[model samples]
Target: MLLPRTFEALPELPKGKQIQVDFGELKVKNSEGKTVKLYVIVFVLSHSRYKYTEWQEHPFTTRDVLRCHENAMEYYGGMTEEYVYDQDKLMTVSENGGDIIFTDEFQAYKQDRGFRVYLCRKADPESKGKVENAVKFVKYNFGKNRVFHNIESWNEQCLAWLKRKGNYQVHNTIKKRPIEVFALEKPHLREVSAPLSFESNLGSSITRIYCN
Candidate 1:
């Protein structure tokens, strides 16, 4: 029998060098008091543990992923050099011989944005533990026992909570407020000249429109 090989500990990432992205689903009551499922996209800076989140009423497509990514970068006031992700369908199509094949839309977006993509190996959740913990934190701390009036209201409250609690609170592992660390990391991040464009596919050619 072969023994599993151990890997070295991950090194401390440079500020604004890497960001991890993930998505989670939450079930909550809407304005009509009917239970509905919502999808949340989360992005976490590797060095500072700073995070950003956005909610969608339905499952995300490639376009949605692109839009969320742009929004997250804007929220952080810049972009990172690398982005890590799981084997999510919206971004990844396949893994052929250790090479990841990203979806066309994601590939296009990556080309336009000019950032490296890193996909965690299968069953290796620990590789992206920061964003994974962010998802869990949002579900347990922000979503637990919460009464949401609607998607809009939930998002509004989420932003307020992020400002008051999530970003300001001291992280257990880092022992520092994310917002404070983020302030230091902001200068190292890459600047964006303009907003990203969202493309619509109609028959053959694609039409792109800028979004705020």
Candidate 2:
């Protein structure tokens, strides 16, 4: 969402300006032949189309989201000036008339990072399509018809797939591999900082992460 006014403070958003974030899930069979669901957070750098995806066996909670953000930034080697999102309940309490009250924990994290946010309208796809497509890509290209041995194996497979095809293949719109474009965009992104001390209030924890 490269909308006006909100970013007037900066002359213009740099190439490494926004990373679109979205949630998705896939159903697959485990070794026991029982079906299970894996939740995912798909991140796409708007400038490069470079992507990092994290998966969990259970649905994602606020803490998982926060920790994934760290891993995504680390994967990119830095953070962007702003993040683009839809009306995800994980971060926002309400979007009533655009008042935009964020969850207390997310609000604190946003302030501490000193980055900006662009919240897309509910149910709107155009604004954040890159990541939405990424979610689908993960489902069809990687997760569909694939065996889920365990969380660790699924992630390791995804990582190898990302390196082999997901980020390496030339994107239809960009006409260049995401990694190639990301090389140019990376220098302009904000430097990665020490991880924030966000912990889970939820009882569960993620076992493995692909990035950092």
Candidate 3:
């Protein structure tokens, strides 16, 4: 026999305290006039609804994941105290009895950067609703009807879109432009004392042992 869990309201998050991350896929035409699937990783500040996105030609490896984190942090000009993620293998290895076993590379990155990691429970997309909507907004707003010559052009366009549309538009829930909200949140963000070197080849393996 099993007991049902009680419902609890989501906690109110402070500025620069939490960020939610998710990945979405988009199909775009290449120079050869064939469609290619591109992975778009999204990071959203939970308190301000500010976001950063990166487009990649392939699914993310551990190295790519770290690089993306660095890029997002750079765009935001700081880091948050906690990162919320789904059960993606790149970040998490398993959920053992309510304890999260994170991937080695990500664990090292978290320890090195000194931020906490929070994983949403299985099948609970609402736990990270901000980033989930960000994924959809990117797919429908920026990605739809867009064509790219190559990955480089796609990335350039993404930054342009972020400037012209994504961050500038008033968010429905927040009722303010992300840029405006981010301005208030910016002062609360943690400054990185030393940045990670993405050039270094961190070992990549889906089978890497999880760390508690």
Candidate 4:
């Protein structure tokens, strides 16, 4: 018999503001004509559709994932009070009845950051549909849209396009352009502890798998 899904329905935001984060992996070939994998975990603020994406070459543990969020928050200039995610093994320990036991690493990450983590139930992908859609959008639009001379260069180009195309575009969900929403969100964001800069440890967290 199929197992029963137990995750709760996500509650709507009170003031038409929400954000979602999720991880995804894509396969591509490298310059030498070999297969490779790319891991990109992205964050999108719902009302504004302001987006951030990070790419690495390794299976991220919980700590690595949280760092990705921190980078994204730094990019966005503030953290959302809640994040919607799938039931990844890195995040959750167990689900008994309607109760979810978050993994120690994931729980600690949430506590440190101060946000509620909502998990999509097993077999219930729609709970985090925005992120799921964003993942597919990145893969087909960003991943397959063009050929790259190098992965790093491709990623830089991707970030540029993501800001121009993804972040600046008007979202069907909110009917407001991301940049416009971002302007509004900016005033509400918490002050940054430090200026945004590339994190060094992200390089060690991923392995390169290239496809030709």
Residue range 50-161, candidate 2, lDDT tens digits:
8999999999878889888988888888999889888788999997675899987788778877789899875667778777788888788989989889898889899899
Total clashing residue pairs per candidate? 0, 0, 0, 16
C-alpha local distance difference test of each model:
0.83, 0.82, 0.83, 0.69
Whole-structure CA lDDT of model 4: 0.69
- lDDT tens digits by residue: candidate 1, 44-117: 89888888889878899888888888888889999999999988888888889988888887888888789998
- TM-scores of the models, in the order given: 0.89, 0.86, 0.88, 0.77
What is the C-alpha lDDT profile of model 3 across 1-212, one tens digit per residue? 89533222366589989999889998977667889899989998998888899988888887888888888888899999999888889888988998888888788888888898888865786688788888888888998878767788888888898889899999887789989989999999999654566565544422222335
* RMSD, one per candidate, in order: 4.8, 6.8, 7.1, 7.9
Candidate 2, 87: how far from true, in Å? 0.9
Q: Which regions of candidate 4 deviate over 4 angstroms?
A: 1-17, 148-151, 190-212
Which residue pairs clash within candidate 3? none
Worst 10-residue lDDT window for candidate 4 reads 203-212
Q: Candidate 4, residues 118-191: lDDT per residue as tens digits?
A: 77764676676667677777877888735445667867887897878877777766777878878877666654
